[model samples]
Target: MWPLPVRPERSYSGEIRNFSKLFGTERNRFGSLHKLTLYYLPIAIFVAVYVLIILRNLRWFRIPVWTIMMAGAVAMIFSGAIPLGDAYASINLNVIFFLLGMFSVVAGMDLSGLLEYLTLKLLRVAKSPQKAFGLVLIGISMMSAFLVNDTLALMATPIMLSVAKQLRIRPGVFLITLALGVTIGSTMTAIGNPQNLLIALSTGIPNPMLDFLYYLAPPTLAGLGVTYLILRWYYRKEFANSTLAQLQVNPREAIKDRKLAKLSGWAAGIVVLGFFLVGIAELFGIQGNFNLGTISLLGATIVFLGSGRRREILRSVDWGIILFFISLFIVMQAFWESNALQSLMIYLPVLNRSDPGLSLVTIILASAFFSQLLSNVPFVAVYIKAMQAAGFTGADVKAWMALAGASTLAGGISLLGAASNVIVLEEAESRGSGFGFVEFSKIGLLVTIPNLLILYLFLRVL
Candidate 1:
């Protein structure tokens, strides 16, 4: 039962031709649409997400930053800007794991009240308000150099507020000092903040911890000194004749859980030791597979196993930040894949491979500016790729260090410039005392300019 042969013009190919003619070339139109979606949609999503994040404080658009980033990532996936598998692969699990471990260890310290106890002990050395202010800046910044700055901001805010109350001054000045201190101090070490950690792990730099300290510590110390002088002069009236000797602060009272405090303190110490050991080994030409992430996770494991209050500590971890990084990776991956930034990259200062001095200046300036817009971590993630594209490599130690320093100091340029600033602000606001954006920026500008100059000069000389 053979069917009747179909006419040549009425074939499937003929139907496609007819459909193309009727609909103005369906394939071409679809192709153009797909290209538009792939090439341009991610950029729109990226800008929209950033806008939402910047305006999130507005009453009408009060959304969590993490939610905005997560939504953008989803949009990218759904819009076909990037594939699902690639999106999944884009997330740097090492970063996520490292953050989780550090957060857990810090959480244990915070929940056990060890951080407050130690903070008060450090600040107790101040006999006068001026001295106390200096102590606060130095102590918090030093702590931030080892502990991640955002976590320190969270732990230090209430303590600083209490110190302010004890000193009989407004909390505003102390909050600003803290915001700047963390931003400056975290520049000195790879594990000092999330962005620094990202740079350390992503750049494939050998002995990152040692390299960071060697390059950044001088600038950080100088920056802290400058910060102290600036704050003292800027708020001289607030601390004039203010004697901390008259106010009694008992550090022992800050300890809530003695056992947990002991355990967490030891755990933190071990982590720091571990970091140094790894760096020293690398310096001596010995190499190991264990990285910062593994060392931190080991410390976290110690806290989890030894502390009875592990659940409470775990709950205190900033999962939103973890989620933010995860989402950010996907969104940035999509943008990178779409080649949206290629045009813009050509306009950036040329990162000369031969003249690192020229590259250093360019990297520092660019990092300082864009960090304000995208925040340090996201900017570093994007900029690292850009640096590589411009012929910089892991062996360009000075350039990478410049990036770490500038991006961190840039956080002190504005309130929204660093995650630590946001943490401090949110913590202060919840306690009914906080500095406004403009108020912070005023002090921030004074602090950031000198710090950036110091960083650049030190990097150049070193």
Candidate 2:
């Protein structure tokens, strides 16, 4: 019925409709193929890609880091090298659920303006910039000990930047300090990072969260103190002059909605308490065990329904990161199939399993060194199975914990060592602030060397 001039548009719309129908109909087919690829072809491609990346130096290619990691995961699946994929599947589900739940809780809090309120309150309570900085660092660190470091980093970075901007100081120092503190704090709890999750999932350790807290609390606090001391020693002059005199704190201005803040805080507390209850249930060997994923999803649902802001909370979720992890799981699964990991394990003489203490030290040091070169997340992933196979005992666990501390904390060792460092640098560049790698290193080394020594003593002698 359309005129000739409108016929083309009508035809186009018809074609689009047909295409959509076809695509929808075939969507399951594509999904099945994707699963097949992950299960079957993972080993071959993983080996090929890994060699290309490492030996041929294809890292400069435009491919995303997540893509490469996914390839590695697929390789793991095919090789069956881990022999624990089934187990890890359950673990991953739980972690994803827990993350989802925590994210929902945090999202509710964010919407409620609790973070803003807390920041302003703390700023008001502190006497000076230095004291404020210390308080912020400590608070974020403590929170991150239980929460996801990435979440903490992502949330805190923007607030820090805003505060720095208002204070008329270079945002670099504040941003970098917060990022590093978050990373350090993440190591304090078992649920803080992917590495901690992997360690807990793969190990037979009972009450991993509690056990980690017990083992890591003292050392982590010591590390924080050492960091403060080192920073003072290295940046004493800067610290003295750098005061947030211009920064003002007004709780009413900082928080847009006090009533919402109160509600969100209460909800968040409930969710956190739920987490504690889950842990307690596990500790007491409760027969009716709830899946962490289910709990997390349930918590998220509750928050969404209770707050009547489902869209906002959903928007805050990092679906890209989630997909990245799923892809990574597939790649790792493939890596296992290719027997590549087993071969690598054979060559790494450090995992001799004969001298567990030495091996533990080696792993920790090696992780720290390589993390400085590559990255801690990937380094942790690559070495996890090997370390476990190396037959670590109670002392080995202590050593591994120390190693995790070093690997994560030493992220400040250089600009390239930590993603957080890079993020801070990018922000500095945007603000036209001069934050060079060399300068950061000078500040970082003062903290790193002593921390390493302290970790060594803790793992070896203590």
Candidate 3:
């Protein structure tokens, strides 16, 4: 038989029209509806049903919270809410690969007993409860800067809980400390947080380790100092009768498998080195870069093939978080293609201004506030296009960069505020030392208020 001609892909409008037929239910709307009844009726029905389901949380037709979010994202993307571009997809791929590599290396470290051994040794050196708190704060912070806050919190929370149980101190307070430390530390590097990556990609900010510190370092120092002081005041009564003498645990005892520890450390080091090498190579505009994710997968493959630890690593990885990013990336791409974000920027009163510094401060404050409401990653992507459309210059770009950084930092102030916050809290809870949102937000407010102001002031000075 003669082959049937392949039809051209239907336009988006055509596809939507076809999908509309599935939900076509007649309704008497105010006795007589307008001429565009078919389109209007179906949309009205969909909206009514959707709102009802949401408000009632109906069991029969309920969707997962994530799926609902993705649906809104689809609307926003086509409606110009997000405004991420094709270029963003490439950047995201790099980010995903980098994260994958990092995760693999971290998995190896966890399985190899390196992280556990290091945790114990660090704790042992900390001896007294006060010192232990300090070390835990510093260690988790440093790890987060390199490994990202989410991973650092996931792996470290249980270990911190174990230490708290042994030392007989309040784990909740320390858990808070660990959580804040990671949030603060994450501001130091682009790889530390998703928003940081967005800022880097959008603003063309290079050497985040250095560029970020121009604004972030000072605030982070203030945050760290403030965090310490806050913890001290809060925990002063707790530490009043205790000492920080190093706990008596032999280093050898902590190393369950020295061979595995060495292998894991080496693998992790290679993954980290890849980032540094890529950063350096960027100076010459070279490609062939392997990101954190790819490096992690490589390390994971090694561990899986050689150490027989693939199953455990796969089970342990945050698959949900990974999928969230994938969906997020697609939606962001849609926003970029649709130019939805640009339209939103046109509507923002702050960007329709003449003063550069004022524009800078406004963007910073706006980003900080919205980040608390919307996820920082999406917020960053949206505003980045807004800032660009507003004709941000070199210095203006710097201001926007600072704004993105501060917005993410603001997330440190609330529990329902950031992904990292939820991850850390959930992990701690899993180990029987969970914290409440009210409690965390109470402490977070103290940190966020002052820290955001400091960030604003620093940006003004620059």
Scored by lDDT, the top model is: 1
Put down candidate 2 lDDT per residue, 1-462, tens digits, no spaces: 765564333447888999999998799789776655544455466555544333322335555455665555555545543455462662366656766777776776666667767777777878766677778777777877766676666666667877767655566667767766777777767777656765655555566666677767776788778876665465555566656777778877766556656656766666656656766887778745464456556767767666666788789875645555565555554455444576667555476557657765676678667777556655665676666656664334665576566677767677656555655555555656536667778877776777666666665654
Tens digits of per-residue lDDT for model 3 on 1-462?
999999998679876877665445333342245323323333333243235324323337545334644564455445433344642442366566555656666766776667767777777766468777787787777777777677777777777776776666777877888778888888777677777765665566555445665666776777677777777777787777654442455556656556666766777676667656766776667666354455556665665566656676667666555555555565545444444454455556467447767776787678667766665665666567667767764345456556666767777777745667777777776766787788888888887777777777776776
**Best prediction by TM-score:** 1
Candidates sorted by TM-score, best first:
1, 2, 3
- Candidate 1's TM-score reads 0.92
Better of 1 and 2 by lDDT: 1
The window of 10 residues in a row where model 3 has the poorest summed lDDT is 34-43
lDDT of 1 at 181: 88
Can you give the TM-score per candidate against the true fold? 0.92, 0.78, 0.76
Give per-residue CA lDDT, model 1, range 136-250, as digits (tens). 8898889899988898999889998988888888899899999998889889999999889988988888889899999999989988888899889999998875667556678
**Model 1, stretches more than 4 Å misplaced?**
1-24, 346-350
Root-mean-square deviation of each candidate, in angstroms?
4.0, 14.6, 10.6
Q: Evaluate candidate 3 by giving its C-alpha RMSD to the native, one decimal.
A: 10.6
Q: Candidate 3: deviation at residue 293, Å? A: 5.9
Cα lDDT computed for each candidate against the true fold: 0.87, 0.65, 0.64
| Worst 10-residue lDDT window, candidate 1 | 240-249
